[model samples]
Target: MMYKFLFWLWLFIWCVQPKQSIAQTLESTSQEFLIRTISQVDFKQLIEKIKTTHPLIAPSIEMVRCIAPTLSVWCVRYTNRATLPQFLTALHAFPAVTDIQTNHLLTKPRGRLISDPLYTQQWQLVNDNINQNTLDIDIDAEEAWQINTGGYTTHQDTIVVAVIDEGVLDSHPDLTHNIWRNTHEIPDNGIDDDQNGWIDDVLGWNFKTNTNNVNNDGIGHWHGTPVAGIIGAEGNNGIGISGVNWRIKLMSLVKGQDEASIIAAYDYILTMRKKYNESGGKQGAFVVVAHASWGVDSLKAADAPLWCAIYDELGKVGVLSVAATTNNNTNVDTEGDMPTTCTSNYLVTVTNTNNFDEKITGAGYGKQSIDLAAPGFNSFTTLNTGTYGVFGGTSAAAPYVSGAIALLYAMPANRLMDSVKAAPAQTALRLKQCILAGVDPVAGLQAFTVSGGRLNLYGSIQQLSAYYGLHQSASILGSLNAYPNPIKEHLFLKVSLTGATRLTIQITNLSGKTIKSRQLGTLPQGIHRIRLEMAHLPNGIYLCVVQGSAGRQVIKLIKK
Candidate 1:
């Protein structure tokens, strides 16, 4: 009974707003609807005609609310109570109106909440023990951190991840430090400083109200904070959780209760990326990836083309959009799902997996449409209202890819990314290739996803490292060794660095799946023996990676 109820609830949520933020909509409930008119329609004349012909509702050209000048769509609001169908027929009677659509409420997923120290509890970062449960798994996040902290220093501007959600906790204790700021446009000036069509978009623009005020997550809905946190929450702060890009700049683009608002948000991301490239990175955010964990449940929507084109549009301007597949446990390839099924190279659909390395019963799957899976069940992340919780869903799964992509782009050694940035047209495809090439293959996933594996940040990093001729560039610890080959559950590491140095050691399977990771900060230069307990590991061959500031060393290990 519970399984049936949960399935029904998941389907209903997927069919409706996808998340549960509809009841918390900040948009006026005054029966306002969106209409797309012919491009040749006169803006002033249409307003006059609507007011004279139909007195039931006040209609106006949404110049401020709608950013696309090329799009002929105009938003309309009802004044007095009237039948929706009556209003639609009255408006469509005119030759100017081309199409009419209602506002689709957007939502985010919720999960069980708990408080615990990070690293150990977050199984997605590093799988603790060798258990038979395929669920005891992670994305090798800890090992990825060893490659570069999100605070990694690059000569260029900070990497920006555009989070198109309800809104983010602008003042969250863990998020405030890493939030992106528009230095080109000064705050509270009441003037268009940079003149990017916004008056004072000191951070990012809120497409719903079309204002500089982007504070939307502090209230009822708590999606953006956790989503953003998963992407790039401040790292090493001794505060809250760690994101994929700990030092990344998070830009919040507000999602509204309507399609127009969603469309406007994408336009904002598109505009910013163009400006950044056109100005040689002097202005606009260095937006590499846009995170959209929300989308239609199915591809049956008549306006699927309109929505699918968004990924292509962003891809054209050098931005990859990591979107979530439906949370409902159904094959999107047959029944079909929107945005996921959208044939855009820039769209990377992520499914969910619990700690068991197994797909959750409620998450969606597709052999051709879905790209990959990530740790989504009970992902520990930041929440709205300055709290922390576990947010579960494909929504939570997508940001893992977002953060991983951002880390690659932000890293200094990424030559391919550097080349791709020079040409925006190839950005989407190249980024997709770079990411999918490094996944750890799963046996049962062969027919479930395109990649047939889960995301492996360390593996991707190594690929880039080899491509850039930086692989094994420096071996700070000379002739390091691990004791007891083919031993069971325990190993000792011998270090030989020049002086006091911080080292990170990782034990990974041959497929580059990280099995264990340890962060040893600042040790003496002389030979020191470090004992590691790897109990519960099943018999297998594995690789041990020892990384330090100067260089990295890899050794093969076996278990019996």
Candidate 2:
């Protein structure tokens, strides 16, 4: 009789649970809604039209505001929340509206918080075999620091990274020296000194209230401070823990817990970066990396097209965005997570790992979507109250990658830096390639991320160094290009020469079997285009070795 009663009780609870969840979702959906409209539609005129058409509910309409003007995204709020369903149905019928989504609340994943100040406790930077943890599971930051200290670049350009979250405590003792300041704008002058449209954004703009105050609230808005510290807290300081880049600029792009505010913050970052690129890096900030440690869970890219599209826009201006996957253990590929699932080549998605170099049980993973993992569990970092604390989650994982990118930019390679200035987009893609190619392979991440590895700062620096060494011309070879790489019948090869030398081409398979060999004797000092017919070669991978007077360079080719 007791077993029968327990079975009925289980059934009763299961049936009632979903009803409660449904009611909560319905109540939450009634307040605000986000809509994407056609660009030609005047947003203010539409708001007036809605007020005139809905006479009875017009007085209850709280506010209508533009979120992303370029994307034509707007937020509509109503005081009479019960009318949202009908209002949504009515708005969907309009031709100008392309897509709509319930304005879901954006949140940072909560992590276990603890207070610790000793650098030895920061096992994420360098493992010391404490508390039965694995050694060498860290990001190899110490070794990378030997190569570049994340301070100024060889050209002495100040590298800036934008932290898009609630807000970063710019006054934090460890972070104050590294915080980015807009010298062009005057403080508290109530004027747009820089003429960037934002009034007196001396530090960074706060999109939550459209103000210059970008400090974190002492409430649950505690994620951004640690994130900024992780990216760039003043290193070698005797106060708290060290960040990834010791002498880097951290720009605080404050956001609210909603999509509108996040989009607006991105707009500010985009404008500043575009200005930097257009003005020859004289006026605006040199923001190469942007870190976003907060996002919506279970949100698909299809529903949030405008949000996903911003990553590409940021990339064109030479900014690489790093996003943390949801803290949930579910696979992001199957369940879908925003920004991670968004198909943008410029965006690097990271997941969380622990001190043991293992994916934490609570962290999200996706073999196809996630790029790599980082040490995020129990990471010792700076806090909003000018103290230190241990924070965990994918939120703590992403900034490590962002910092690594900034450090790579500081490497003393003039050739690489010139390439970055000439072709910002292409160089940004190359930077992403270096990071993905340099990750340390981890057993836990083998089936989880595209890199199948965890972040290794030293390995990435070495990879970038090797790339710079390989591309070095010694004043002989200017450039080498191969097109239609995955070839069918013919391959086009272009070689730029600064001096006369015998040019030889050799094609070899992976097993070192020479498939083709040719010597075009005594080329002049100019660009030479040659065609090779690979119609007889089978569908496989081959290496095209180009030999010149200076040295030999290898280019990987595919035939299909």
Candidate 3:
């Protein structure tokens, strides 16, 4: 009788265990949706309208809300399981419905060791600019280094980055020193010394099991370590490679995380940041940003409420969260991607580009959705222990921006928040704007990313310099910015100057024929707007040139 019972139990265990690994356990009764019902419709009217539009969500259970922003709101509900997918895709067309998300388990990209050399292979850092003739296909990290080498400054020693991914090789030679340690907790004491709800969390907590056991991140998982190396692999160490921020701290947040787990991770980081700042850097991690390299391909409105709600708290703490878009070559604007697609002002969505400064075949894009692109193709960084690798994906592209953000905050030349005497909220906004304002206007990306440009660290530094009056040269190069792009009737152009000087502005078509030229003699040291009439011009792309005492700058213009 005992033998027969054991055989039956073994069969049951095998069947159920495989099912858990094969598919995610979804919330059968719950669904989440985002809507613009504030002015359009009330809560009761919205729910009744959804039921009227699709009766399949019948026998509805309780409705709850995780986040209810002033303009857009997130709503949750319990509905029929069999009709959820149909109801969601159907709601895509509804004018009142902005998003229909589901409870999806996110996945991470696998990585491998590709090389065994020193820093010469780190092309993404300093592309000798001779990528078979293209001059500037790299991020120009050296220029940023000239501004600040991640060295110690008055503000802080190093900013913290909470890396959200699978797992990392904590013992890697290049990454060991930069890891974030939870000094408040007692290691291996079998007790929660800090009373933060996590025991023995000497290192960053493992959200998967809600335990301190982070070393058991599995053998095959190789994503987190490399991404961490890309962000803050100690520079000038004369050992392996250098990351975007030469001297920065990394907080490892291992994934296999669900919506609730992700929220918990952010919550933990926020708590640590608060403790650090409130205690005058005496305790807690001063995490400035969170790096999320793994995500679901598509997040229905049902799956996004908690994350959206948590992001608000993140922004309030002066932290920015950057997410990588889908890796497929398809457009995210027409299709869709998650976290990257989540509408949060605190989030920066990144795409992948290659060595030739062009979008890779498998990299995703979106004119309205994707914010920017970076070098994710065959980009070199630390792999597992004692190994260097070349990896390519949106996952790889994201850390570059993360590390770049660290560099931006480290510079004493940062005047983004210096001039206007900004409030805390405004300081965070200025940092975000500094990133968006200084991109290098890629030709092909014109219709894709919102910036229509690639990340340029040098340009960002120059922007800060000009803003702070740090540039002591009157021979300043001006920036030409045109608005209402694809203009049909009229276009407005702002010519910005660093110091007072005379300026010559002109417009031309592809044939190099001068469309118009305007001369504003000896304009004051500031911005001047020039309007170009385009109603009579043909519907084609044009160029605008700004020539002044500082230098000459040209910008591309589109007329619809």
Candidate 4:
């Protein structure tokens, strides 16, 4: 009896132990599944999905850094006469030349000069007859006007815009004036001049080398000079191309393509902002904008945390972080990309458009994420050695907007305030309006971007100017409110005027068409309530203009 009982107990123990081992293995397998399936999922996409499904997420503006530096050169040539065969043969014979093509003058020499070796030419033609004036281009003119009209000749503001990518050609004539100087630390002193954790950041810091070698090596992908040219090329210098905002100081925080270096560069920008603000210097407004023109592919969404954190920190300090919308052509709404994908409210995400007002085929798009489009493809700008090239990508587009922001900041008291107040928010809103108000209603907002409707710089400037005027007056008026802002029902207007005056109310769509207008009788001083019935209006965003003796104010109202 004892032997039989022992055998049964041993068998039971063996059965129970194997089952327990199998269960443990299954639990271990489940844990591994969690790491790969759940933990490894794209955080940006998950956050974006939540924001879309859940309004509480309130995904705000995010500055994306997406443009990669290109080592290739671009060149163009002009002939004494129209001779395609001779030109092609000459171009092909050139040692540095790689590709060549002809323009409309193939039949006759009357047409405009054409770009040869389109992709990798280091030199380009400057037709003396063909309005080589940069002002002829809409972007160049807009930038010039933004600076000249504002009367901001001196660099008194001294705001720093950090370029985090390849190093800058520190010696470039056009960029030398605006390059940041570490005043605290002396240059070439072999000491940590400013003692800001850097040995020598004379012009700007380079994290890639962990030193102050800001020189453009002409190789190794330090394309910082071109990026700098976009942000603050010295204007009216009679040399090279013009920058967007020539007055602002530019700081270079160089970083490699690695994630760690990128994070270090971001931290460096924040640190400088903090140190500058703490120093009690006249230029208290330090590092107002950061330009990042590179992005990771959508498949690498899991690795966007560092960029997202940098973007978030920039927003916290009132720094307007600008990022490229990417040249990947992926739907940013669905897939995730760093810097741009990180949904931070203070960031201004920019995509690329071509000179013809059409979205570049490769420019990324999204209704929820992408803020606006700017000139990108076949655009000409300053290159490395006091030269210029025609490069394409959202990278170029990002700088155009960056320069525009600088110009807006330079406007007069009223214009400056108006521009600064609404530039960030309006950038996002205006982009949405431009995209939504497409030529084809069927394709809706999506088709309008790339289907031949490029970025309208002239129109954007006009809109920004008008918006600035409206916002400035509204600030002074005070105590004015519009209910049902995303109007799904009858809209309500409440106003508190300081003095007795007649108020005129007008509602118009983006097309400048007056949808509704009314003259309100004189109202007694203090708060008064007025209502506009818009239940019959179609579903779209409308701008409500209120004109009084004070000034005109415009507010966006959506009719759902």
Task: Pick the lDDT winner.
Answer: 2
Which structure among the candidates has the greatest TM-score?
Answer: 1
TM match of model 2 to true structure:
0.63
lDDT of each: 0.70, 0.79, 0.68, 0.55
Model 4 per-residue lDDT tens digits across residues 1-560? 99999977875554344433333443322111011112223433433443465443222212111121142322222212223223223223323333222211111111111222221121111111123322112342332242232214123445567888787776777677777777776788789756677776777767777888866756656466777777777755556655656467778778875888888888877777766556644322366677888867673344665567677676554466788876877887778666776777666677775433456778788776776666666556667766677666888778766665555545433344333233434443443342223211123235423333333332344344444432233322324446545565577775545346778999996556898999987764444557788879865546888887765657766554
* Per-model TM-score versus the true fold: 0.65, 0.63, 0.61, 0.53
Which residue pairs of candidate 1 clash?
19-107, 19-108, 134-356, 134-357, 135-355, 135-356, 135-357, 136-356, 150-247
| Model 3 quality (TM-score) | 0.61
Candidate 1 achieves a global lDDT of 0.70
Local error of candidate 4 at residue 473 (angstroms): 17
TM-score for candidate 1, please give it: 0.65
Per model, state how many residue pairs clash.
Answer: 9, 0, 9, 21
- Report the C-alpha lDDT of model 2 over 1-560, residue by residue, as the tens digit: 99999977875554444433433564643355677899969866766777688776666565577888899998766555455444554564466876666665442111111122466678887663555667457877765654467867677888999998878887788898998999999899899998899999998988888889887756667878989988998877667877888899999988876888878888788899888889888888889988899788999889999998999999999999999999999899999998799899999999999888889898889998999999999888988777898888999999899999999998766477788788889888988888998898988789999999999886676577666632333656544546555566888776655457888999996456788999999886544668998899865556888998775767777654
Off by over 4 Å in 3: 1-117, 129-133, 151-153, 216-218, 301-303, 414-422, 468-560
lDDT score of residue 269 within candidate 2: 84
Error of 3 at 471 (Å): 9.8
Over 4 Å off, model 1: 1-117, 130-136, 151-153, 471-473, 476-560
Candidate 3 C-alpha error for residue 443, in Å: 1.4
